[model samples]
Structure formats: C-alpha cells, structure tokens
Target chain A: MGVLKAAWWIARKDLAVEIRSRELIYTAMFFAVACLLIFAFAFVEGRTTIRNAPAGILWITIVFSGTLALGRTFERERQAETLRALLMTPVERPAIYLGKLLSLLILLGSIQVVVVPLVGLLFGAPILRAPFMLMGLLALGTTGFATVGTLFAAMLTRTSSRDVLLPVVLYPMSLPALVGGMQGTLWIFAAEPNYELVQTWLAMLVFFDAVFLTLALWTFAPVMGE
Target chain B: MKLGDRLIVVLLAVSGLMLTASPYVIDTAPYEATMGLVQRIFYYHFPMAMTMMLSAIVCGAASAWFLFRRSERADHIAVAAAEMAVVFGVLTLITGPLWARKSWGVWWVWDARITSTFIMWLVFGSYLLLRRFGGAGSEVLAAAVGFFGMVLVPFIYYSVNLWKTLHPSNSVVPSLPTSMGIPLYYCWAAFTLLFVALMSVRIRLERSRGWLERAYRAVED
Candidate 1:
C-alpha cells in the first residue's frame, strides 16, 4: 500500500479501537476537566482574575492533560505487545509515526473541543470573537505537541520509567509551541486583541511545528531500532 | 596515568590556582559606575555561562556521533559532557541570580538569555535522568534527546529574543573596559582548561566502568 493509505489505515485502526473501548477518550477528558477545575481554584480569585489569565490557564491545562493522554495511548500499544508486531510488518516507519501522530491529534482535538468551551464558560474568554482563528492556533499547537509526543512515546515504549520520562522529555522540547500557543490564545482573549502579535505568534507555532515534526521523523527510525 | 593525562592534571591545577586568584584580580579592576563591587561576580559568572553553553554543544555533538556510529566512546563522551553541562549550568544558574539580585534588584527576571539557559539546563538534566532511569536502550534515547537539544539551542535563543525581556543583552567582551576585560579573559581561559580536564577525567571513568561491566558479564557467562 501507499504510505498515505497505510498511514490512514493505521490511524483508522487506532480510532476504531478507541471507539470500541472509549478508555483513552473518557479518561483524558476527565483529566482535562480536573486540570481546569484545579486551575480555577488555584488562580481564580474572582471573575477578573480568571478573565485576565484564561489563555495561560487554558494552555497549561492542555499541556498537563495532553502529556497524560500521550502516556496512556502509548501504554496500550506496549501492554499489548502490538508495537513490535506492527514494526515487523513491511509498513514504512515514517508512516507508522504519521499514523500515530494523526490519531493523537484526533484524541487531543476532542479534548480541546470540550475544554475550550469550558474555558470560555468558566473564564469568560472571548473565544467566540475569533473562533476560527483560535481553532487554527489550537490545531497548530496540538499538532506540534502530538508530533513530538508520539515520537518520544514510541522511543520510550520499552523503557521501565516511561511514564515519568515522557513528560520530562516532552515538556522542554514542546516549550516553544506552548509559549506560542499561549501568546496567540492570549491575543484572542484580549478585549483589544493585537492582530500583528497574533499573526507573529501563529507564524512561530507553524515554524516550530514544521521543524520539530521533521526532526522527529528523522529521529524516530533510529530511536525505535531493533 | 599516561603522560597526556598527567599534563591535563597539571594544567587543571594551574588553572585552579588562577581561578582562586581571580577574586583579587577582579577586585583590583575599576568598579562599574552603576553596580560597584557586586559586579565582580561577572568574571566568574560570564565564564561559567560560556562553559555551560560550550558543554551543551559538545554534549549534543557527541550525542549525534553516538547516533550515527553507535560507538561506546561516543556515548561515554556524551554522558560526560552532559554531566559537565549540568555542573556548569548549576553554577551559572546560582551566579546569575546573585548578579541579577544585585544588578536588577530582583532575584530572577525572565530575561531571554536567562530563560534560555534555564531551559537548556533542564534539557540536559532530563538527558541525564533518562540515561539513569530509562533502563535498557536508554543511551539511544538519551542520544536522541541530546540531538534534539542541540537543534533546540538556536530556536530557544530566537524565541526568547523575540519575546520581551529585562536582562542586559550587550556583548560583554566587545564593550568591556580594559580593566574588566583582562580579568574576564583570564577567567575564561581558566574555565575552559578546567572543563577540558574534567571531561577527560570523566571520560576515563566511564571507559573503566564499561570495561568492568563487560568483565563482570564475561565472568557471569
């Protein structure tokens, strides 16, 4: 099969399994909600406080829960011993990475769907003002997160301390994406949002995603060696 | 030890003495019009920062070599360089806050260089953590982290620069007065010598440990 088709097939497989089990989806959503509630309690002194800091809080929630989701998703493959089986197939390695990344993006995207609305409700963010732009920024940011996260998850699959190592490795590498996402989201939330600053941050997110995805692709094959 | 190892040890000793004497040298330099005596920390602070940056690059390069060659030597060098990076990074972190406290009137400020160095320090710290706790094939994974970290240095620098920050971003060497410049260079030379000496010794230790592991495995077999 062609690489694209093979990748789509693998992504479909993961989605089908997830649809059947609903284990990763339900747990990730619960975690994301829990994170939002904790942030609300910790930082939300009043309406003004939540309104002022919604973007930072939102992104932090996503990052923390996203790390959790990545770990759990990869744990399934490792537990089933399916990763080795999949590798033994003739499917291209990069295709496997892309497939995994795509599924993670879908998983994270669903979490965002619920979390973004809750952020708007709880923090009174002006998320609706620039809805499409905000979605674009979230998509870009999540793509970057999943791209690197999936690669690292694969690399750490055989490790004993994978749960701890995943976030430790992921967070520093994903800092630029997180910062850019937070900045863009902040712009979206502001009453007098600066178009110029938003654009610049969006461009940074794009650049980071492109560079890291390429690097992850190259590094994945070697890191996941026999 | 071999003649070269002895030479490195002697050079390390001489540089150690120079570093010890550096305080007096810095004291004699004309005080900055703005910061006064507290500015003397710059001599040690600046060199430690340089050594930390150099060690990061060296570690990254060694990691790349390990990825390409899969040689035990490259892995040893990478781990050794990472350890040194952490050591120097800690020194830089502590000295930077001290200087910042006196100069900026704050214990810490999210300045571009400061933030980048802190992030870089964390990256190397994680590199060491993965190696220690990752279990089988951890070196390969740590090597991957090193390679990504090397790639990240410039990105982190640019991103932090693009963001607004309060730290001074001037070129210290080019703008330095003669009085300050002399001691700064002396410290730089001494720190560089010390880095080389430490890396060599650490690499030797790693090699011996690897040999011992192999011998033990052979006996078990």
Candidate 2:
C-alpha cells in the first residue's frame, strides 16, 4: 500500500473508533476545561486577572490535557494488544507514525476549540484581537508539541512506567514550543501588540516544527522497529 | 595493560596535573575591573559550561549512531557522555548561582543563557532517568531522547535570543585579555581531558557488564 494511503486509513480507523466510543474527546475536553477553571481560580483575584497570565495558562492547559490524551490513546492500544497487531501490518513504519500523529493533531485541535475561548471568557485574554494569527500560532505550536510528543509516547507504549516517564521526558524537550506559544499569545494579548515580533515568533515556531517533524519521522522507524 | 587502558591512564594523569595547576594559573590573572574577586569563579564556571555542552553534543551524536547502526559501543559511549553532561551540568548550575549572587546581585534570573543551560541539564538528567528506569529494550528509547535533547540546544539558543537577557554575551570570551583568556582556556582543556578520562572508564565498565551478562546467559544455557 502507498504510504499516504495507509497513513490516512490508520488515521481514519482511529477517528472512526473515537467517533463510536467518544472516549478520548469527551474526557480530554472536560479535563482541559477543568484545568482552566483551576488556573482561573488561582490567577484571577476577585475582579482582576494577572497580566499575561492567560497566555501561559492557556498553553499549560493544552499541554496538560494533551499529555493525558496522548497517554490514554496509546494506553487503549496497549491494553487491547492492538498496537502489536498494527505493527504487524504490511505498510511502512512511517505510515503508522504519521497516522498516529494525524489522529493526535485532530484530538488536540478539538480540545483547543473548547479551551481557547474559555481562556478568553475566564481570563479576558484578547483572543479576538488577531483571530487568524492566534489560530496559526496555536496550530504551529501544537504541531511542534505533538510531533515530539507522539514519537516519544508511541515508543514508550511498551514501557512499564510510561505515565510518569512521559512528562519527565516530554516537558524538558518541548520547552521551546511552550515558551514560543506562551510568548506569542502574550504579545497578542499585550495592550499594544507588536505584530512584527509576533511574526518572528511564528517563524521560529515554523522552524521548530520542521526540525522536529523531520527528526520524529526519521527516528520513528528505528525506535519502533525494535 | 591494553592500549585503551594505557590511554585512559595517561589521560587521567595529564588531566589531574592540569587541574591541580589551574588554581595557580587563575590566581595570576588580573581581577576584572567591575566584578573583582567574584569574577575568578568564571575560570571554573565557564569551563564547566563548555564541558557540559560538549558532552551533550557527544551524547546526542553517539545516540544517533547507536539508534541507526545498533552499535552497543556507541550506546556505552553515549551513556558515559550523558553522565558527564549531568556531572558538569550540576557544577555549572551551582557555580553559576554563586557567581550570579555576587556579580548580578541576585541568586537567579531568567537570563537566556542560564535558562537554556538549565533546560539542557534537565534534558540530560531525564536521559539518565529514562535509562535507569526504562527497563529492557530502553536503550533505543533513551537514544531517541538523547538525540532530541541535543537537537534542542540550537533551537533554545535561537529562541532565547529573541527574549531580553541579563546574562553576559558570548563576546566576553573572545575579547578577554591574554592573561585571563589563557587561564580560561587552560581550565577548559583540563575539564575536557577529565571528561574523556571519566568516559573511558565508564565505557569500559559498561563493556564488562555486557560481557558478564552474556556470560551469565551462556552458563544458564
């Protein structure tokens, strides 16, 4: 089978299963909302919210819920012993990786659909300031996070202590993405937004996505082949 | 002794002698006009940072080799380099704060260079943890982590430059007077040799452990 075709089918399979069960989306979306409420309580004093706190809070919620969702997605595969069978398929290994990444992007994208606006409502972030720009940054930033996150989480599926190990390993490596996302959003939320500076950050995010996606694709085969 | 053993001995002796003489060399360098005596910590601190960065690169390259080529020797070398990165990273982190407290008048700041170095240390520390706890077949996983950690160095570097920074710029080294620059380079060379010596010993230990494991399997069979 062609690589892209196989990848699409694998992604479709995951989405189809998700559509039937509604397991990951429902839980992850609730988890993301709960995460924001907690942050809202902590950062929002009776009437006023901390300056620039919403940007950090928004990214943190996405990452935290994303981590939970990433773990459970693979945990389901592991529990059913389906991942091994998936590996046994005739398609190339990168197909499996791309498929997994595609599904994760959709899952995290859905969570962001809910979480982004909630941050606006709760923290008064200027989400409407540059709507397209905000979405672009989130898309690039989420891609950066998920590229590395998917590679590591998938490789970690066979391990015993994945839940603990995932964050320990994932957070440090993805620091740049987190910093970029938060900073870009902060600039957008600023009283006087620096569109030029935000564009530079967006460019950097693009660079990050390119480098890590190439790396994740290159290493996925070897890491998972074993 | 085998040539590898002899080389390790020689490296250890030379590195030991250089490190012992480093204090006197640093003492002779003139004090900075601004920071005074606190600046001398730069002799060790700069070298520790250099060693840690080099060790991280080595670990990453070795990890890539291990992952692609499936070479056990590369894995051992990568593991040893990771340990060195951690050791020197701790030294860098500690001495940095001490220097910062006196020089910057604060214990820590979110300076670009300092934050990037801290993140690097965390990455290597996580590398060690993954290896220790990742169980069988973890070498491949840890190798992937090491490669990613190394790849992050430049990205963090570039992104940090976009932010405001309090850390002294990299130009501080190239523009230094010969007296201070000499001592600084001397310490760097000494620290590097020490890294090599320690890595050799650690790699040897891993090699023997592998042999012992294979022997145990053979005997059981």
User: Best by DockQ, which number?
Assistant: 1
Q: After the best TM-score superposition of candidate 1, give how far the Cα of residue A97 lies from its true spot, in angstroms.
A: 0.9
Clashing residue pairs in candidate 1 are none
DockQ score of each predicted structure, in the order shown? 0.65, 0.61
Interface RMSD of each: 1.8, 1.9
In candidate 1 the C-alpha lDDT for residue B3 amounts to: 95
Q: What is the TM-score of chain B in candidate 2?
A: 0.91
TM-score of chain B of 1: 0.91
Local accuracy of candidate 1 as per-residue lDDT tens digits, A1-226: 9888888888999999999999988988899899888887877775555444899888988888889888887789889989888888798888899898898899899989999999888877888988878998899988888888998888888899999999998888888887788878887788778767878888898999999899998888888877
TM-score of 2: 0.95
What Cα-based lDDT does every candidate model obtain?
0.86, 0.89
Query: Fraction of true contacts reproduced, model 1?
Result: 0.73
How do all models score by TM-score? 0.95, 0.95
List where candidate 2 sits over 4 angstroms from the true fold. Answer: B165-179
Lowest summed lDDT over 10 consecutive residues: which window, candidate 1 chain A?
A43-52
lDDT of 1 at B167: 20
